[model samples]
Target chain A: MNFKNFITHTLLLLLLALIQIIFLKNLALFGVAFCFLYLLGILNLPIPISHVPLILLSFGLGLAVDVFYDTIGIHAASASLMGFLRPYWLKAISPTGGYDDSAKPNLPEMGIGWYISYSLPMIFAFSLVFFTADQWGTGGFFGVLNKSILSSIFTVVLAIIVQLLFFKRRREIR
Target chain B: MLRILQFLYSLRSFLLFVLLEVLAIGLIVSNNSPQGAAFFNSSNAVIGTVLKTRSDILDFFSFAQANETLILENALLLEQIKALKQEPDSLPIPLDSAFEAQFQFTGARVISNSLRFAQNHLTLNKGSKDGIKPGMGIFNQDGIVGRVKSVSENYAVAISLLNTGLLVSSKIKSTENFGSVNWDGINSKQAKMLYVPRHVKAQAGDTIVTSGYNAVFPEGIRIGVISVVNPASDPNYLDILIDLSTDFSRVNYVYLVENTQIVELDSLHKKSEVVNEF
Candidate 1:
């Protein structure tokens, strides 16, 4: 990534993390589902980034989140897992023509179908690990599953809305 | 060596993943373990300051409600003063002076509170600097809140009565039948009273007050009122519900009560135990 893009990504990550901690941390629906908009930073990373940096970034992001939530390491663990699986997910869902090096994996760069297919599994994986670690020894498997599914849905909806609001599309050349 | 290097390189991502997960789990385990008096959970300065700022903004919106509560408490205090003056020979002493020299009350503001968790906790703005120590009992004008769990320099975390782990030694006001009150984790507005014999005539409106058997709280602090009574399945006790007096959702200001005589009483009890053993 160029220095300009690197700076932009860092600023975006900070903004998303702040919003998650300050505002969305308290926003729970029915006391079960929670919105984790901070995952948008991880999900929207450029597709060409390698696995090591991606996983490290995920860990850092999760740790930042954990500091605010007062949860020691649960978010970091889950974010690392999500980062580890992102490359495989991109490879598995590659379109008829391969992804362009310049393309970013966002709503504007990729259509709704590709974005959902790519992001949903990553969000679900992250949520499953997160809620499982959070409710460990206190709740049963069914409870974990229910929380993960509901939270994933809430998180994905919020993430999509955020993308639509902030992620601008590049104009196509004739 | 080349093959081994290739293998290691190929598995580097997986290794990193495992290493990070182990570190995270290690942190979780260490955090959950019982540690000394250091309030490791939520009393950190940064988190406390952030929460305090948020609470301050929210407190601004609830100014009117808070004012009403303060006015009511002031009126009650005045009435108590008037009643005390009516007595024949008793000299009027300051409220704090009336208690033994060992007890002190530190005023604290509740900066963060939670009711939804099975184990809920409240963060207060006063801490060690304000003489707020762990084991100090907290109460609002209406009733008992909880005891201090841990304290940082300027912040203290109290385990709220809504938490499942807290049990207040209590008795019915009319019959003086002793029991313990605990949260059943079902309702925020209600708690369960345990160990009361089934034969005790506990009515729906009977009041429950602290028995002062535990050194944590003084005698006769109001806890709640009996709301429901049913025979326990064990056939030895009654399953009673209490309508909690202190509306925890609205509790902002609280008094942290430090019992001065607890150490003396505890030592005396220990001595008596030794004598009995002999």
Candidate 2:
């Protein structure tokens, strides 16, 4: 990757992690505390980033957080799943080669509507995997099911907002 | 040899990603077990300092209100002491023998608190070094908050009733019904009290207090008011939901009550347990 692109990705990745740790982890709404939604870093990666590398990057970040969070391998697994599924999602949501060739995925390349649609399913799936794996035996099978669904809904709502605000709008698709 | 060099050169990025993921997954798997140590714990220097700074900034607004609350509580406590001097009847009832050795009070302030979860923990400004030990009762002006869990120098953590693992023994005053109060993990305004006998008459506004059976919190310390009572047909217990007297979401400062004579009482209790075990 070019230096500019490389720096941008690294900075954004760290920034997302910083925001997740500093703000989101501490947020308590209703009685249920929200989960960290930092996996958007993997999802927002430029299409040029190879799928395996993207997945690995997300897995690494998620695993690091898992250590601090005291949860098991669930986050790593879920983040990897998000990385693996990103290509399929881009294909499903984008209209045939429907991306700017030389630009990163942002609001300008993918309309706000398209971007939201693209991120929702990816985030929802990752959230389900993460919550289900953690709450697995703790809540029984049904408990896992309950946590997966409940947390996905919450995670998606928050993730979409992150995309809209920070996935910056490129002036012109290169 | 040529193909090997080509493979390494062409797939280097992919290999690096795989290696990175492998390391992360390894850590996650390790932490899953019961003895699995905390991996991403915020106690790390980089995360801790950043989190601490941010937590302080967000709470700065409330620190002022917390200060006011502490001042108001001090005033109220002073007034109660004055009233106690003039009229002994107004004092919290002198403990009956069973409870005489169970409860003690020590003052503490919230060094850090977590409320945004299904289970929450609070850290106090006192710890083992300050003679504060785990399992001690933590309370505030309105009522019970939680019990101590872990302690370090000058700081201790309490597993708040919001935690599912916590089961504090409590009783309803008027009916003498006893139960364990729990947070729904869904509501800060309320908690669930279980094991209350269905036969007892429980009504809205009836007082629920700590039973002191656990020897952690003293008996008759206000827990909450019974908001609803639901009974299960298969069991003899009733579900008692309480609107907690204290807004747990807003607890900033608290009193860490240390039962000075815990060692003596615990030994006696264990002796009885050992006999029963046989």
Candidate 3:
């Protein structure tokens, strides 16, 4: 287990959460907004560091958000599943060891196309699960599906923007 | 069997996704029950505090409108008081059956209210400690808002007139003929009474008041007026639209009416549980 990678993952998740709470929540483009960017931190974590711990971490992060926002364990349950399934999906998608053991998933490290391919599916899966659970408590099946799709699309776009803008330029090495 | 087992193994993620989703649904459905609900509901102290704080922040913006409404209502009350002095022999109108039943006014402030939602609720700044109980009627000088639904130590939440779940028994002010009024969910200013029957002569301006068919509210408390009446919409019942007398978006101060006789009535009813049909 690389200590630097864990620290990077924690800092990134907290920063995304801060941005989501303070800024992006109030930002609406035609009433569609991104809020679950913090999931990227979990998604970007390297595989084989025991999936259970990461899933628990995602669950905790989601519960923290719910506590702040007054939704129940909806987000927590969704993110937990995403974290549990993370390793299996990573193995299935990237058999060539695309991600480094000591590194984070960024454009400079994995290239834009590999990053896009890797991140988009995880982003979709996680967002689909996260917003769907968030809605199930308040809204029924159709409502959950609608919010899941909209939030997932918005999340993916923002995830790419964050990838291209902040992490893309700051990379000192591949 | 091996092929089926392989298929099951391949589909484990999808099944797990569904299982998690069901857990959430189960949480919600179980929350509807009396006991299984407390775990994940807003009853949780942390969730309640968060919602309370967020609502408090949102309530700040509505203060200006609320103040203007209170001032207007106060001025109108003063005017009525002055007018009553000029015209004697007219006793001041009494409110609530609780007065007849010998209960007192429980003062409470509007903490939170939602107008635009399909289902709406209001939270008041008083609760069981202040003698506010569930099913106690809440009102201002103008008219009814709702009855308390849930109560805590220092606060209570109400199912408002704007709620789709609420079915209030009301009467036309002139005839006192009763009907059931509910929010149609399309308009905040309008509610509809479906089973009023077309036989009665209802006009566009007739006032509606509580009919006291139910114990929730006393008779003659104002609800709204018949703003639009389509008698021909259905043969048996008239389709009536009501313009609410009280602007809910502006309500602030309210009186929570508590009936002390309820305990006695409940005890008597419990004692008389076995009725002799003969």
Candidate 4:
């Protein structure tokens, strides 16, 4: 990425982290669906980004959030898993013409159908890992799965709303 | 050797992922144990400052409610003082050593808190600098909140009573049957009272209070009211649920109580080969 793009991404990551810590910390929809909106910072990175940096970035961002949430390593572990899987998921779902060199896997740039197909399962995987770690030895697989599914759906809806409202279209940004 | 190096280089991302995941899991395991000191949490200086600033802004909107609660508490304390006041003509008697104060209380602001997670925690603005220490009991006028888990220079992190790992020693006020209050990880407003015998007459609306058995909290601090009493699958213990008195969602200011003689008590327990459960 260019220096300007790197600066913008870092700022965006900071903004998302702030929102997650300040506003979304205690928010749970109907006491189950939690919004891990900061995942968007990792999810929307340029497609050409290498796996190593992506995993490191995800781990760092998650740790920053974990420090605030007091779930010390839970978020970091889950976000790292999500980051590690992103490249494979992106390759599997790449469209016929394939992604542009500068493509970002976000709703505004990737269109709704492709974005849903790409982001939903990744988010589901993230929520699954998060709730699994959280509910470890607590028993009730159904409860974990219920929370995971609802949280992923809730987070995706919120993520889409945020991207639609704020993120610039690829053409406009370029 | 070059071919093996090439293969290792090819699997670098996977190896890094495994390394980081192992590191994170290690942190989780180390931090999950209630007695282990937490290394990374809101108790850190920078995170504490950030959480405090956020709370400061949000608390502004709730000032009137907080003021009303504080006034109510003040009135209650004044009434208690009036009841305890000695008559002016009464002769002063030297108190026995048994009458010495065992617990000291301090006030703190809840800067950051979370309830959605199964293992929830809260961050208090006061820390070791303010006489806050790990294992101090936290409560409000409404009910018990939690115990301090770890403390930094200017902040402390507390495991909320809603955390599945925290078990508060408690008893039914009516029946006098004591048990451990444990969060079942299913709900925030309710917690399970474990080890209550199946024959104990626990009922809905019965009050639960700290038993003083654990030594972390003084006796008689309210915990909650038993809302459900059922025969558990274990058949030996009762499945009793208590509606937690502390409204954790809006918990702002809290009173922390530190036992001055906890070190002595802990050492005594150690002498007897008993584990300290808090």
Candidate 5:
């Protein structure tokens, strides 16, 4: 990524984290689903970013969230797992024609179908791990499953809205 | 050697993944341990400040409800005072000893509260500097809330009664049959009371009050009302559900009750246990 792109991504990540902590932290739908909008930062990274950096970035993002939520390492563990599996998920869902090198995996660039298919699994994976670790031993299996699924759906919907509203569609400069 | 190095390099991401996850698990395990205390919790300074600020903003919107609660509490206190004045010599022996003097109450605002989780906690604005400490009982006008878990300089974390880990010694006020109340982690508004004998007559709406068997709470403090009474699977006991008096969703202000004689009482109890061993 170029220096300008790096700077932009960093600022966007910070902004998303701030929004998650200040506004979205207390928000729950029907007292079950919760929005973890901070995941947008990790999900939208440039496809070419290396595995180590990606994992580190996700760990940092999760730790930032953990600090605010007072949840210790639960978010960090989930986000790290999500980051490690992102490349494999991308490969599994690669278009028949293959992905363009410069295009970012976002709603506008990847289209809604591809975006949902890609983001949903990633978010679900994160939520499953997050909730499992969070409610371990205390919550029954059904309780963990309930929280993970509901929270993932809530997060994904908010993420889609955020991407559609704020992320401008970039023109290919071929 | 070259082949092994190549294989290791190929699995670097997986290794990194495992390493980070292990580290994260380590943190969770360590922090949740009894010895971990509240170092990484909402009661810590940075998170506490943020939550306190948010609660302050939210508190503005609940002024009317808060006013109503205060008025009701004031009237109750006034009534007690009037009764005492009317019959000074006839005052209850417990009241004659200055019931208020044995406990010091510090008012606190709850900055962060969670009722959805299996184990829930409340972060209060009062802390060590405010004379708040672990083991202090917290209550509001409606009823008992919980015991303080840990305290920072300016913040304290209380284990909410809704938490499964907290068991309150309670009794049916009408019959004086004692039981212990604990959250089953299913409902936020209801808790289970155990150990009341199957033969004991308990009905829905019977008041449940603290037994004060544990010195954390003084006797006769209101806890809740029995909502459901059922025969336990074991014929020896009754399963009773209680509707908590404190509506945790709207509870913002609370009083931390510090018992002046707790230390002495605790020592006396320990001495009796030692004597029993002899």
Candidate 6:
């Protein structure tokens, strides 16, 4: 990535983290669904980003968010898991023509159908890990599953809306 | 050796993933203990300042309600003082050292709080600098809130009563039957009262208050009211649920109470080989 691109991505990440810590910290829909909008910061990175750096970046991002949430390691563990899974999931769901050198896995570039299929499972995995760790031996399996499913759906819907409203469309440039 | 080294290099990402996961789990385990001094939390200086700023703006909207509550509390205290006042001619009695106060109270604003998670916590604006210390009990006019888990220089984090991990030693005021009030992680407004025997007359509407057994809270601090009583799967105990009085959602201000003689009390318990569970 160019220096300008790097700077833009870094600022976007900081903005997302700030929004997450300040606005979304205590938010829960019906006391079960939680939105993790900050995941978009990692999810929107260029397709060719290597796995090692991607995982390290995700771990750092999660740890930063975790410090604010007072959930010391839960987010760090889950977000890194999502990061570890991202590359494989992307390859498995790649388009027949495959991705461009600078393709980003965002809604505007990947289209709604592709985006939902891509993000939903990844988010679901993230929510599962997060709630599992949060609830840890206290909640039953069904309770964790219930929270994970609802939270993933909630996060995905909000993430899509945010991308649509704020994220620039690359298709117009093409 | 060369082949093994090459294989390890090829699986570097997986190894790093495992290493990071293990480190994260280690943090989780260490941070879960009630007495553990956590390093990375909202109590850190930079994060605390940010949270305090956010609450400063948000607390403005709740100022009227907080003022109303404070006024009501002041009026109640005034009435108590009036009732206890002696005639001008009456001789003052000098109280002995036994009558000295054992708890110190400090007022603090809750800069950040979360109730949605199974393990909820609250961040207070006061810290060690303001005489806020770990193990101090927090409450408001509504009821008991939580216990201070860790304190930084300018901020403190308390494990909320709604957290599943915290257990407050309490009793039913009407029957004097004691139990531990624990969150079952289902409802934010309700918590489970454990170890109340099946035969104990723990009826609905019975008040639950701190028993002062653990010395974290003084006797008779309100916890909640019993909302549900049912037979448990374990025939020896009753399943009793309480409706927590503290409206955690809107808890912007809190009072911290530190037991002055807790060290002595704890050391006594240790000498007797007793575990203080709360």
For this target, which candidate reaches the highest DockQ against the unseen true structure? 6
Q: By the TM-score metric, which is better: model 2 or model 6?
A: 6
Worst 10 residues of 4 chain B by lDDT: B226-235
- The candidates score, on chain A by TM-score, as follows 0.96, 0.83, 0.79, 0.96, 0.97, 0.96
DockQ of 2: 0.33
Go through the candidates in order and give each one's C-alpha lDDT: 0.83, 0.68, 0.67, 0.92, 0.86, 0.92
- The DockQ-derived docking category for candidate 6 is high
lDDT string, candidate 6, B1-278, tens digits:
99999999999999999999999999998899866769789999999999999999999999999999999999998999998899899999998977789999999999999999999999999999999989899999989999999999999999999899998999999888888999999999999999988889878999999998888888899999999899857779999989999899999889999999988888998899998665
- Cα lDDT tens digits, model 1, B127-175, are 8988888889999988999988888888888888987667888899999
Query: How do the residues A1-174 of candidate 4 rate in per-residue lDDT, one tens digit apiece?
Result: 999999999999999999999999889999989999999999988899999999999999999999889998999999999999999999999989888887778887779999888888999999999999999999599999999999999999999999889977758533
Q: Per-residue CA lDDT of candidate 4, range B1-278, in tens?
A: 99999999999999999999999999999899977878889999998899999999999999999999999999999999999889899998989978999999999999998888889999999989988888899999999999999999999999999899999999899879999999999988999999888888878899999999998899999999989888857679999989999999889999999889989988999999998554
Please give the distance, in angstroms, between residue A8's alpha carbon in candidate 4 and its true position after superposition. Answer: 1.6
Q: DockQ score of candidate 6?
A: 0.89
Model 2 residue runs over 4 Å out of place are A26-37, A48-53, A63-77, A87-103, A130-174, B1-48, B83-108, B111-116, B124-132, B152-156, B232-234, B274-278
> Candidate 5: lDDT over CA atoms?
0.86
Q: What are the per-model C-alpha RMSD values against the true structure?
A: 4.4, 5.9, 6.8, 1.5, 3.3, 1.3
Question: How good is the docking of model 2, by CAPRI class?
Answer: acceptable
Worst lDDT run of 10 residues, candidate 6 chain B, spans: B31-40
Worst 10 residues of 5 chain A by lDDT: A130-139
- The CAPRI category of model 4 is high
Runs of candidate 3 with Cα error greater than 4 angstroms are A1-170, B1-23, B33-37, B40-62, B80-125, B137-147, B155-166, B171-210, B218-255, B264-278
Name the better of 2 and 3 by DockQ: 2
Residue-level lDDT of model 5, residues A82-150, one tens digit each, is: 999999999899999888989798999988999989998899999899878766766688977888899
- Tens-place lDDT per residue, model 2, B145-223, is 8887656555565677766557778888887877788776556668888767777888888988988776677778788
* Fnat of each prediction, in sequence: 0.48, 0.36, 0.13, 0.84, 0.57, 0.83
